[model samples]
Target: MIQLPLTPPGQTPLRVMTIAGSDSGGGAGIQADLRTFAMLGVHGLVAVTAVTVQNSMGVKGFHEIPLDVITGQIEAVASDIGVQAAKTGMLASSAIIGAVADTWRRQGMADTVPLVVDPVCASMHGDPLLHPSALDSLKSQLFPLATVVTPNLDEVRLLTGIDVVDSDTQRAAAHALHALGPKWALVKGGHLRASSQSPDLLFDGTDFFEFDTARIDTGHDHGAGDTLAAAIASALANGSTVPDAVAFGKRWVTECLRAAYPLGHGHGPVSALFRLNG
Candidate 1:
């Protein structure tokens, strides 16, 4: 493992920006991202794309943020506060995704900053978070600009039209997703119920790295994806390469799953606060 002091004495904490949505439930979206960023000892910045009426039960509804305001937040932060790496989650519409892509490119961050795209299309309870029309825009604009695109199994099928039943199919899906333009495609097999373990496949067009863990037995994993992506972005901001960053994220998130707790009356959230307990 590539070890570095996360918060060395007397140095500024690196900044990591998350362009995502607000979860009233507070288990996922911007809430989870910021929590993960802070846990990793990085400055957390936000460009909130939408506000959702959701809870541990599920998403009831959402209202998208104005495109201009979304872009403005990105500008205000990158221009002054500065972001070393960024990630996206729960963009509600094609318009928002396209605008985010355009704004990031215009700011000259398209190539400079590493971006983790967590394609959050639906809530864990099967409630849709993204607009129906936004899928194409997400792929056409945002995917091309991502350093690494992390997608759950459902998202893998949505992105590549492949059903990931095993490691073989996951690899195929990774290849198909890589063809969409991200430098890396991480196919998360957390939902692969047929398997005894959760295996994630990372492909960089030429090479493949696999990260897996014995599945934590819990229904309270609401923020796992967001937390993982946020951890990856945090590592990138702290100067880790993409592969190392993903590895770090996997380890951190696995620990989080071990500490997940029930919330509300339904499925709860994966605990990003796990480290605090340790």
Candidate 2:
């Protein structure tokens, strides 16, 4: 039987890390990741790769953090605090991707922990987040080390060249990504026709599972992907299997989206703090 992490006493909380960018608007990126971690009852750590000037409207510009600083943050956390699972998002350049991949390997996280990779190529508002030239490096250096790769429709198309117009093409996109060496691939269908039914496809190279929720019509789903990926990492750290983690993450996202609110005049972000509502 699986023992729960929350025991009688002296049990430390599960530790999860996010290797991603910082969003000034606090809607997505590390903000959303940490929010999800806290909500899911885990300790969150961060290694910010970029600092973006963004908001509900769109991303204006971003500055990639130096490789040394990124490594320093990861080492500081991994050596002392220790992470059970980690997730990566918004690796803006090839240099950063290579550096993170190297660091993660050196730390032995590739073999010891579950690493969820969110291929954040573009922002929720359609702003490009990663450099076009860094695409190959992300696929070559990081994808192989990932335990699970999470990509949306645009990212799937960017990585596989398949226009995911329907369920059949969506399956093809997930298989193409699974071919890149990640043990599992989760193709987010929130931006595809599957969004009508709020379905996300999970492919493990052999079989595919579709997890769905009632589609909530709202523009405040800006941080939904980041939140979902982070929640999965948190759940994995807390001892849930990949399928359970994905299902729980989807349910959590649906709840957040259902309670979403307008934070700004433009399209807003989902309410990660929805637990406080009831």
Candidate 3:
């Protein structure tokens, strides 16, 4: 847990950093994270990992940011402006993942600051964002440093090899992911389409907390995963407990879904325009 100043240095809002890729679509990745942070009253900082050519239709392709530049961005923000919490998105390759993990560890933020790992394997349109060879690196290096790992069903299967079809299996998946070393595991059930209301389960080794919400019928949920993870990271920056942060995030993203609107011919993004009220 991070203890943040109500008014950080230079009298700015509590700062939360998103060490993620840029979504030219303005739907997910660093774009969605910055929106979530701003709406939640925290200043958002970026350490862009990749520049993805993507939109409502799908991810066409991407260009990875150099490892040195990625590390430099992280250091530039952490050493100067500082961060109350941080989260990771599309790390395109094994080298990038290694760079981020090593930089974070060397900065001594692996334990001190709150870290949210959104194991983004693919886009909503079924496009692979991470390199196949980097999956092991993601698991081995990043997971152990995460304060909370937010993985959807697809990611859950990719990481833990568990098919989360029901509540029990969600629990099993949570346990499996927690074993990878994150202090908390959040298994999002937003991918479970058959259920009218599938609750996201959060496990902290011994106990389990489920955040149940009625399903909103909409296909414009392209950035829902990123939105949820960013909301958690933002709340952590705001000094919320892990359970409370997850709770707030669940509510926040549900509204984002409720406010979702269509953009392109295919699936659109959940609106981050659903700002938090004073």
Most accurate candidate by TM-score: 1
Specify the highest-lDDT model's number: 1
- Could you tell me every candidate's TM-score relative to the true structure? 0.97, 0.95, 0.95
Residues 155-178, model 2: lDDT tens digits: 999999999988889888988999
For every model shown, the clashing-pair count is 0, 0, 0
Q: Cα miss at 170, model 2 (Å)?
A: 1.0
RMSD of 1: 1.6
Looking at candidate 3, what is the lDDT of residue 51? Answer: 98
Q: Global lDDT of each model? A: 0.90, 0.88, 0.89
Question: Tens digit of lDDT per residue, candidate 3, span 1-278?
Answer: 12223454577788889989899899899998888777676889899999999878899999998889999999998999888899999998999999999999998898789999999999988899999899899999999999999999999999999999888888899999999999999999987865779589999999999999999999888788888899899888777899999998899899889888898788888887855432
Encode model 1's per-residue lDDT on 154-201: one tens digit a residue.
988887899999878988999999999999999998899878999889
